[model samples]
Target: MSAITLYTGAMLQGAVITLELTAGATVVSLIAGAAGAVGRLYGPRTLKAFIFGYVETIRGLPAILQLFILYFGLTQFGIDVPAYWAAFIWLCLYGTGYAIEIFRAGLQGIPEGQHEATAALGLTRFEAMRRVIIPQAWVAMLPALTNFVVLELKNTTLVYFIGVQDIMFHARLGVSNSGQPLAIYGIAALIYIVLNGTISRVGGILEKRAAIAS
Candidate 1:
């Protein structure tokens, strides 16, 4: 079989693994992000300080460093883990920090008067946030959050560093098998563009909806 054929088949498995990592990481980021944002906004000063420190620390580190720290560094503790889990945990944590910032901006974007009005009308703080504040924050944050998720889709390739056999790895495998580096890597790059482009289009639609809501 030709190198292209061999790599093309490998690319299929790589795509599958890539999608799994993206989906898993996105879910984790969103859930953790929203919760963390709420805590940063409504939690006590100590909690806000803690969240701020965590966000700044992760945002400052290169993702490759984070992956290495999680995969090799953590494994030294005798905690059995696989490349898939390592990539999943690191990406989700990476995305979580950014998502927290996005969510914080969304929460702050809501008018202070809106909060006052909700409370003046007999709503408790929790009810005000739940019924009025969060809905609006979601609208404001949807665009940024969508963009973050699409980025997550691309970031799944980081799994290659930990040997997850992601699409990039498959491209390498195919090149090895067929000795056609040019065509194999070229095709792999095209697939990434296709995936991220679709996400960009979706983000535009969501942005429009958010604007309309506001």
Candidate 2:
């Protein structure tokens, strides 16, 4: 049988797992990031300080190190995190660190007059942020959010280090079994390129639409 035929099933399965990890991480990270941004921007001093420290600390650590701590080191603390959960959590936290900054910058980029106008209309803070502030900020946030998604998608490969059976893991298996490192690794690279390219294309379209809308 041909190498392509031999490896197609395993690669596809791996791709699905990678996509799942990316999707889950992206969603949770965005939610956490938005909340973190809001807290830093509008909450009291203590909340802001706490969020700032969390973001700085998470951003400072390398993701691989964090993953190792989650998967391996946690066992010493009598908390055994499953490899898949560890990977998922790592991706979410890592993405969130950057996402918080992206969202904060986007929200802050809006003019102070916008907030004033909302107050003048007697809109409560929650209503103003939900109805007026966030909608406007989405345009500014889209490009950065898109970049974050792509980065997270690529970073999913790191999950295989803890044996999550992602694309790279399957590629390694294919290499070992078929002894065709070039073909296996080449296919893995192509898969990533396609996924990243798709995200970029979609992001570009959204950006254009947002620009026209604004």
Candidate 3:
């Protein structure tokens, strides 16, 4: 095959790999984040502290360092995970912290009267949250969480360090093998920009729909 032809396939595969990791991380993070956010919002003092600690700790640390620790340092203790798996785990952890913060912010953005009205209607806290609070919180939080997903998609390139052969990694290989650094890297950049742009557009549409809903 021609150099460009082979490189294109590799690039596509790399993009898929990156998307898979980001998708998995997004799902995991959203669940954990929603749970953590709710925990912080309504849990007792000790539970709130623990949730706060987790979000603070992850947010304070560099994600690259976190990935390295999980991939390299943890492996040294014989708790080894495959490079892709390690990358996936670290990404989930990193994204989860950010999601928690976003959800918390969304939850807080909710009006007090909304919750009060639910309780005034005889709804318990859980029912109020399930049927009233979370849906509205989701709308308020959509912009932030959507932004976070786009960020996670771009940041998936960091997995290259763990030898996951993601988009950046394949782009690097293409540049090295073809001696066309500009072409290879530019292609990767365009792909990422397009992907992120699409996400942002979708987010905008979602926001509009949410505005209509609320």
Candidate 4:
């Protein structure tokens, strides 16, 4: 079989794995990010401090180190984690840190009077955030969140380091089988480009809709 054909056929499973990891990470990041932002913005002083430290610490580390800690380093200490779950958790945690910052910036961008206005209307803090603040913040953060989603998708390739059967891992397999590293790697790169481009287009559409809505 031609190298391209071989690589394409073998990559199906890897592609599915990539999608699954990306979807899981995206969901985790959104939920965790929103919570983190809310805590940092309005929670008690101690909670805000804790959240800040957490975000800063995670953001400071390279994601690959985080993956290595979960997959390899932890095992040495007798805390064995499965490779797939390790990747999932690491990406979610890594993405959550950035997501929190994105969301926090969105929240901070809103005028303070809006919060006061919600209070003036006798809305509780929770209700005010839900009804007034979060919607607008979401609109502001959508582009950044979309970028993170794409980055998380691309970062799934890093799972290959821990032996997760992702696209890059399969590409390596194709290279081994076909002895055509350049062609196989080219196909892998194209696959990544296509995936990221699709996400960028979707994000553009969403940004326009948000602009019109706002």
RMSD in Å for candidate 4, one decimal?
1.4
Where in model 2 is the C-alpha error above 4 Å?
A: none
**lDDT tens digits, residue span 1-214, model 2:** 4876668568879999999999999999999999999999889999999999989988898878888988899899899988999999999988888899999999999999999999999999989988999889999889998999999998899988899999999998888889888878888888889989999999999999999988
lDDT of 2 at 142: 92
What does candidate 4 score on TM?
A: 0.94
Q: What lDDT score belongs to each candidate, Candidate 1 first?
A: 0.86, 0.91, 0.88, 0.89
Better of 1 and 2 by TM-score: 2
Q: Where is model 1 more than 4 Å wrong at Cα?
A: none
Per-model TM-score on C-alpha atoms: 0.91, 0.94, 0.95, 0.94
Worst 10 residues of 3 by lDDT: 1-10
- Candidate 2 residue 149 C-alpha distance from true site, Å: 0.6
Which clashing pairs does model 2 show? none
C-alpha RMSD of each candidate structure in angstroms = 1.8, 1.4, 1.5, 1.4
What RMSD value applies to candidate 2? 1.4
Candidate 3 structure quality by residue, lDDT tens digits, 64-181 = 8898899998977889889989989898899989998999998899899998899889999889988998889889888897799898997798888778989889888888899887
